[model samples]
Target: AMDDREVLLTRQEVTVAEHGDWAEVELYEAYQNQTWERQEVVYYFSLPESAVITGLWLGDSAERSERFAYRVSPRGAAQAVYRHEVRRRVDPALLEQIGPRQYRLRIFPVEPQRRDWDQDTNRMVVEDGPSLHMWLTYRVLIKIEEGGDVWPLPQLAEKRNVYWDDTSDRLVNGEPMAADEETWLPPAVPATSFVEPGIHRVDFPGGESVIARPASDEDLPAWPEDLHLAVVLDRSRSMAGRQAEVRAALAQLRRIADSDTVVDVYLTASEYHGEEPTLVELSWLDLGSITYAGGQNAAGLLAQFEALHAGQEYAAIFVFTDGSGYELGDGGFDVSVPGAPVWMVHLGDDLPLGYDDATLEAIQASGGGVAGDVREALTRLAVALEGEAYDVVDGYVWDVLPTEAADARDALDGDFAPFAARWLILAEMQRHRGEINELETLDYLHDVAVEYGVVTPYSSMIVLVNERQEKLLDELEARGDRFEREYERVGETEGQNALTVTGVPEPEEWLLLALAAVALALLYLYPRLSARGTLFTKVSHH
Candidate 1:
């Protein structure tokens, strides 16, 4: 398996075009493979919370007309198409949302090229290699703060999976190379629609407009002077050195609340003696004496809290954790805070995939929220408590034809009706989460995603070479998650079994054999479980 460093990011160019309240951003990236064997590049990064990916293109040529832009389909179908194309040695690209505010891009079979270290020039230069050029465009509503509406840009943080420090002075095609540090966008004047104090509607080219209205005081619940708050601390191994930060946030929370507010602090991985209510002043000292150790016991902590409180309802419950590894006692995905609205605040830099799912489940079950940090969690909680809301656009009304936005730059002109429809569907899905059956909700979302050509949790974007591939994708989509596949054929060598077939289009003999070897190698290295709950055995070489 190739690591993150094998495929070199040779060049990057970004263009930001602003259109009123929202902005369209296009990112062009070129990656070079220095190895002799084919490679698949997987890039994992985050975008703005409100950003929506509208387009993606992959090709060897720089000309936009020569390349194919991917169309939206069910993620499962797109994945099937990508797999089918990969075996045939055809060009295909995929973009998927792996978690909240996180995305993954996959480009396969980057043709082998070469680069060597040049001691004379004191630079490792790219001798010759094929470059994979990619174009990604997304639209985001600008952030309106105290000063002005700021267009959000991609943050190429050093912690991202694809990044290189300054120590590696490298050159691509004899040109000086460095990683992208910042993005450039055109400046804009203040948005008057936001500053005005009345309900307003801004319409796009289509018969659609975003409507905003001020939040009235009647919309908020009455604030309670005597509020009971539960603070669940994740005393797991991952929180070893973050005690001071958590303590500081707790102190700030206490300061924001009334003096008579009751506080109960509990630690995971420790036996809950019972609901012993501690004041902020008392709990502040007790928190200093606590030690951090053991795996996260989120499930156990919630269970203990339930046992102690039983019928007692609090203002809200706050769980502090990095959403990392859990101990054996933790309930894993089955964990839930049933009685109260549980706000799970991530205490780390990047939220893990498992944790993100767990937080979403918790939120859906309890009706609270998940924040990237403690500060955000606190601010949102204050707004909910005070019956206050930010004066931003409430929602958009648009004639959404999910299937119509097939063009690459469909949303570039501020016609975000499809994107708006996608969000509306998602919001409805969230509202009906616990009410409707799981299968029904999933089916509804999947149908809408495919019909509207919008990328949801059930949908993704994939590039196909021909109509056959498109038909093949439809078949795969019909099969759904129950699509059982096994590779049964190998190369010309007898007594060798490499892959199992699911009755799709067959690849050429040479490509089939090449795929067989690759399949066998991959199976031997990583044992994959089939859809029927069976694992394939390693093939023996003669």
Candidate 2:
């Protein structure tokens, strides 16, 4: 395949090892630079919604590589270190989440190809370009849908040189299962039953096991009989053909509504009906009339929605959009909704291309949660309004087995194990961000991310070249973690000033060094010239 902008995705191979309820997915990618200069290859990808990143490795050759699972640091510090190391022309790879199920992989200095001689032609020949290979592995809980158990792999936009290695021969270390061997599956747990709050374990292949526990059982507040709903619809250019889907999703609200339910519809790119909440019947709310045009202003539309209903309380607020052209306004949504929950209903089949995970997390933290589809949105809304618990799992989940698994290893030996813990922890990390007590929340998330060895917004996956680089990362984290403690004691400004990390010299420092060298040279030559006497010039002044 032809390269794109001198960056060629030479090869991509994915291996899926399914273990009943969950699967381990390993993706290998090779990139080559087609030009005569070093390059930074940036690739964007998306994975299953329930996947947890567990490992990342990068190297010039496949035989040896550096692992990113060695250390866990705050995202900002990790980014700063990555920039610093990249400037030094050292090996450092960064994998960060850009949106829900969306990730950005950055590998530096794809070295240029070496020139060679053509003996027969009596001309210079160009050899193949240098390549960088990366291996990424993550654990995903199998999604149970109407079709069957599904494990979604990373979907890359570039389809060239890609291979899916899920054949039976390669499913388990290139060994196929015997025909007489029976497959194991986890014990069936009814979706409606109330699971106890504690650590639960399940066994998997290779003596590995998974564990999970419920987080909470807090029921939704009772719905208001006189419901006043405000729907913020996105009218961006990307929503042109998706208007029908939005209308159909909104029409489902009528199913759970009482006769008193009143709705006010506001378009993100259009003028509102009026200052007063224009009560439209659920059946008569004509979403078809709202034209999809211009860019989406989610923050401005929400502000207007709240402004128009000043001194009034709403039952619930629904934001309908595919999250394209979505911008995060200044600070988090600090508005007081008077006990009303904000439901961010995603309205597309694809992963949101524009909005990052932060935007969705912030909205969910504002009292409501994110719904994957129209049916999920309607179901969650009904549950929230009616104060009835439906399908929900509350608790912390982990990829590894519980501490108690060691003592009961023999007893717990089985084929199917509850491997949903890793996904649970990943989901909790998303919600744990942007909490009221920011410091404590970050501390908790950082610990969990490190303990589980997963990449998250609070924590990032950073691959270093050697031991010295590891020391540098450790030092940087120490400085940042210290500053976090100081931040609570003194204030934001003083705390930032107190934080300092030593690494490769900055540009300003290098400039200062150059000036000092010139000054020293002048000082060294001045004495010699003065001693020679011929350099001195005498002048007569009036």
Candidate 3:
């Protein structure tokens, strides 16, 4: 035992009295004054600015949400930041399995913020360091789940520390479960307080991340009770009854019901007769109830969806087929829906041949999102009708790829289609900088390679980019104008902060190099040619 008794910092429990759990959890820390030396601190935690805790549990574990239910903030707080709002309630069995636990917390700051300390003395006093650093703080999230989706179980909540962790504990006023050294403990009293509902946001210490949580009763952002949909299909007959594409699209729609989103499906048949048409909502058409009898009627298909889902909102209808207009005068894929947007998915290889560009534009102008391939199209429908995007890297995956990080990457691999669009702005910046000149280009390429995690860097692309920049520079130099240091930033703020230029090197030097090589080839030609021609003539004479 130590000569002096360490002072108890704070103690509290999260569950209710119904559990008969007695956790007189106490914490004793060395000390955390900014004035203290390095040894004074011991642990550190980091967290993103925001997160939507779909699930959580106490302490570390191997389960997804249950494992390591802690989230650390990247920003360091030298002093303890109190959050009085956190509340908890749990069953007695949970606390018993966990056992009586006490905390000895500490904050470890990185370099440029190390505290100096005397080797032998356990002094709580401060010392000077080479440099001072910022402080950060991490908090705990004690999870409470009823083992299922049913939330806010009134009976489970026995009591709570209406004001917990922020300040020292007051008397255990409600009821007592045990007698610890200093105070009587309550059989974790239950409380009625729950997390304030509806888009409650939490600010991180540094402010880099933001997450949003939604309640079940409220309407989602960008989505309404009445969802709208339009379908554009390819009708080139090659796709006629090509059950593969339809099955995939319908399967995607089926997943929507799980999230409680409404959807409307439309069938675009370019070859169907008398429908010389334009885009329009399927609901307004003279369509009848769908039987889903493994046939292709708009009404039958929709009814199938309705049968599968509860009373979900039937938002938009999409049609994807492949057939040309039946007659010469038939309008084919040309459809019009001024009010709701039509999602025209062209099936198979050929989108409707000679599909009117004006009609396609009109359909898009009606405010519909498009889908190209099965993967992209399905994801698009989910976002459009579901009104939410999957939470990808909503938390800090960090540089070190943990199992969770790998999981996030795997999900992102299918979700984030990188090839969809190239980084045009960064490409332009790399190009304009003449960053790819000779060995200098090697360094520039190396940087980009590292950024993109490319192991084997290509030298050829560097040379091409450098050559192009040099040629442009030469043209500008010849005009008695050179300003490589100043490419207009596409936007004001972007130009002001990120994009900077320095100088423009004339490409005339390269031009001269090219010309000199040609001249050298010409220079060695005359005598060698004369000799070769004479020798040829003599051989002929012989």
The TM-score values for the models, in the order shown, are 0.65, 0.64, 0.23
Q: Write the per-residue lDDT of candidate 2 for residues 84-180, one digit (tens) a residue.
A: 6666556778766544466666666677654443334433355666577788888765555454445556655322222222221212223332221
Off by over 4 Å in 3: 1-225, 241-244, 247-275, 279-469, 473-542
Compare the candidates by lDDT and give the number of the best one.
1
| lDDT at position 107, candidate 2 | 69
Cα distance off (Å), candidate 2, residue 191: 23
Name the candidate, 1 or 2, with the larger lDDT value: 1
Q: Model 1 off-target regions past 4 Å?
A: 1-3, 76-90, 114-129, 144-149, 156-228, 256-266, 270-285, 297-315, 323-332, 335-341, 348-361, 364-367, 382-419, 435-437, 446-454, 480-542
Model 1: per-residue lDDT, tens digit, 51-135?
Answer: 6787888877678887777887755556666765776666678776644455666677566654343334433344446667788
Candidate 3 lDDT over 19-67, as tens digits, reads 1111112211112122222221221111111211111122211223331
User: RMSD in angstroms, all models?
Assistant: 12.0, 14.1, 28.4
Considering summed lDDT, which 10 consecutive residues are worst modelled in model 1?
A: 488-497
The per-model lDDT (C-alpha) reads 0.54, 0.52, 0.27
Ranking by TM-score: 1, 2, 3
Clashing pairs in model 1, backbone N/Cα/C closer than 3 A: 402-452, 486-500, 487-499, 487-500, 488-499, 488-500
Q: Rank the candidates by lDDT, best first.
A: 1, 2, 3
